[model samples]
Target: MPGVKATALSAAILVSAARAEPLKVGGIDLDTPPSHCAPLRDAEVPKAATLGFVSGAMTASAVYWIHREQRRRRQPGKATHPREWAIWTRLDRKKKGYVTRKDLKSLCYRFESDEHAEHLAKQLDPWGMDHINFSSFINNFKVVQMMRQAGRLKLWHRCCGLGVAGNVAGHMAQAGEAGQESHSATKPAAIFSYYMPPHPYQVSDQQADKKRLQEFPVTYAVIDYPKLPGACKVQVEPELGLLVDIVYTKDRKRVDHLVPRRVAAFNDCSIRSLEGAEKLSMKKNWGFGSKGISLRSFPVDGFGPGTFVDFLALVSYMKRDGEVFQYSVKAPVRNYLLFHEPLLEWIVEQINGQKDTDKWEEIFPQLAASDFPTSSWIALGAGEYTDYGATHFLQPLDEVVVVVYDERVMPDGPGMAQVLEMFEDTPAPAGSVMLHQTFV
Candidate 1:
């Protein structure tokens, strides 16, 4: 009788432990709101219709216009013009080109001259080298300025890479669904984030409210991937994990076929006639059409959900002049440093309004030597700026070419497999978005 009672007590303790969940907020379970509560995030997508008829109409129109334009491109017998040829080449360079990420890293390293290296160290050592994190970016602006003056440029550069990658990856994991879809559900599918031990950046809407309960710092591991010419990326509202979240949109938009407006303007109409109207759509005026659409992805949220990191929305835009419609199969990485006036000033002095092959190498010393992140987001070209209210980001990848990872070598494509392997390689007991992980 005594043994049996002891056994029963043990069993009860086990059951209680299993039932001990993190906590809930507003009647919503922080772990998985959809399951613990009445509705799943994905399950409520149809309710997106409430975004209103006008928003729906605009979305439908934009979607239809995009599709219609695609159909028109299928119409054959169209001769390729020089302008179209140029756009295709740029798109091809970004998609199939030989440039590897290592190439960019090397460029960042090499871009720095002796003077640049000196500047970096000075920035990292603020307060006469006594203070840390002070002017280290996490600290206030005064400290940051002190560090920069002290030569800790490389510190911010490194932090920029990590922060940019984190935000870009988070943005990619979310799917965009107008205003109706709550932030808890679909977000923009430009990037995804996870963490080994969970840090401050790994906050999700689900756990946001519960932070005060457990009071543990949420960690974030950001992952980014590029889209192949044949694929698009979509965001999914799964319980957890990476690839599974990108269930449908792995191939929504590629470098889309564009209308040859420039050719139409110059060849079909005289340049003089277009001077006035082109001024509106011109790259100089609107900062588009100088190139085609370039696809990219970005992680708006630095981490998934569990902390106080600012909300980051993955963004996409078009450059009709470039003739390339880019989709950041993951979203693009945008950072504060790129928006800094000095950065633009540096670029303008280099380009000098025209290509000067001779001076190209001379300006190398001035370019910011950033370790760089997976700048999956797309932009036609640089020299344009706007404040979308984002802080701590990455940019200057205007000419940073990209390429596709072979899909056949390993399923889910190379990028996905590599990212998954990164998780497994860490052999982390970290909770997965989807629990389908296997150890090889």
Candidate 2:
């Protein structure tokens, strides 16, 4: 009693008077609100937000480091884009994950063909793909490859089909290796033309006068390249860019190109528009293949100075002074792409190297010529030249090869050298050229 008496009794009396909530005895209430909510204060909310940001930044840093490492692996001095950076956020199921290769394959699988079914089939074989299955895998680039090689694809169009599926190799594969033969895959290519018919410069003078056709003169210039059979060779430069073909007759005496042929800059004549002369004079057109639609060049030579022939060495020439002309190779359909990258092997060798080869067997028996056909090339337009130029072809030119390389013909030293040499002529493999011919 003595211990509790003094201040305790006074405090108890005061506490009893103050013990109350915002209460109304009848209707009136008495209470004052705190400046902030007790449970969720404004200051506390901001502190929570700050914590969230810090956590998010840490997460983002981890993802960025991974991507940065990946980009570094691809090629030196390469950088990533904002969109690619978004891929990290996508791993969170609630967030957007950009499409991976599987997503693309699914898109390919689901896509019902409106126009590409048959074309895709004939073409699929060269790449060892199945028609519908390949359709799912083939993106814009495969489309371009199909068109360019249609001439060949037509022969075995129904045979190509690839069966690549998602494998764990993607994750387990580590980066870094020295002196590895590297390659890159390009897609949704444009169609390129390989063969253009000789121009009709052979028409008699009366025929020319009657039809009001201009003479497409043939000019001979010496160019050299590693592809030439001997030291160097003189060949007709096809100006698909100029919309003309330079054709050579069995008899070398007469050669002709498409109408847009170049003439020697004559004396006392302004070098302006002599029409035919100005047209044919240029060589090596550079910009023939930019995605799809692009500019035109004159003779594949004026494409870009010193690009292609530089790959070729200097060679001899015999000039045809009489006249110069062009031959047009306009054909059955719209300009399409011709692709020939299939022959290159795609090796993801950590483990799939062997497994992939085995899977090909299941997919290979059904394979046809279309599975392994040449589809496109770096066809140039006027002033277009082939560099790493990713040109497209409308229709691929057909080649009659004598012998296709069989496994027994392994690419060992000299064997491979011969094969590489064949790239120069790109001739029908031995015994393939038609023997029966009539000289025009």
Q: Which candidate gets the maximum lDDT versus the true structure?
A: 1
What 10-residue stretch in candidate 2 is worst by lDDT?
262-271
* Candidate 2 residue 386 C-alpha distance from true site, Å: 19
lDDT of each: 0.24, 0.23
Model 2, residue 334: what's the lDDT?
15
Per-residue alpha-carbon lDDT of model 1 for 1-440, expressed as tens digits?
A: 97987777666656556889544444544456565456637856666655676697898899999999997785321032222222222212333323233322332243332344334344434344433231132223243223222332232122210001112223212222113332233212111111111123445676444321122111111111112132222111111110111111224221111111100000000011122231111111111111111121122222223311111112222122222222233222122223222322333333222232321222111112211111111121111112321211221111111222212222232244333332232221121111111100
Write down the lDDT that model 2 would get.
0.23
How many backbone overlaps does candidate 2 show? 97
List runs of model 2 lying over 4 Å from the truth.
1-60, 68-114, 117-143, 151-440
RMSD per candidate (Å) reads: 29.7, 27.4
User: What TM-score does model 2 achieve against the real structure?
Assistant: 0.17
For model 1 the local lDDT of residue 265 reads 4
